[model samples]
Target: MIWEVFRQEKEGEYHTHCGNVHAPDREMAKQFAAIQHGRRKPTNNMWVVPKEEVGEVDGEKYSFGGTTDKSYRWATGYNVTADDASEVVESSDEQEDAERRRSEVV
Candidate 1:
């Protein structure tokens, strides 16, 4: 059986897929993952999951971002006042331009 390994470098960081280990059971897989993946890096935590247990969702199967106007999440969507800093206004303008170009491409 094959087991997937994910390693987290720090306490608050995300665990990323590192490598795979060939083991007969979960406990042996964990041990093999520690010896193979953990020893090379500053691993704060590690997870060993069976390859058959992992699930995946692809873009062809589902749309990632919903078909809704979510402009409120962008800087350009906010109302700017005169009291706002010039840098803030500049950033909003740049974001607006970028958003426009991105929309055109999409």
Candidate 2:
């Protein structure tokens, strides 16, 4: 099974996908993932998804970077001359409904 580790960054914030873990079942995998990824800090919640249950499709090329030479791929790429935050412009309105996030570290 495929499982994902979601970490709560702060109070009143939804858990974010820190990483994924794979195992036979959701419960066991979550147990493992929690210790490996979340036990170091105070995690509000954890979700373990069977690898088979987690569905993701990588685009033919790169769905995230519409074109080549992506400025979006760099660490400080967003510290650009543009007035708009690249993430805000690219993210759909639906994503905004999920939760707002801020962190000193991921």
Q: Which pairs of residues clash in candidate 2, taking residues 3 or more apart in a chain or in different chains?
A: 1-51, 2-49, 2-50, 2-51
- Per-model TM-score, in order, reads 0.61, 0.45
Stretches of model 1 off by over 4 angstroms after superposition: 66-106
Model 1 weakest 10-residue run by lDDT: 80-89
Model 2 Cα lDDT, one tens digit per residue, 1-106: 5677778867789877788876777677877887888878888777665555667777865567546767777867666554565665667654654444333233
lDDT per residue as tens, model 1, 1-102: 999999999999999999999999999999999999999999999999999999999999888988899999998998987777788888999999999999
The models' CA-based lDDT, in order, is 0.95, 0.70
| lDDT against true structure, model 1 | 0.95
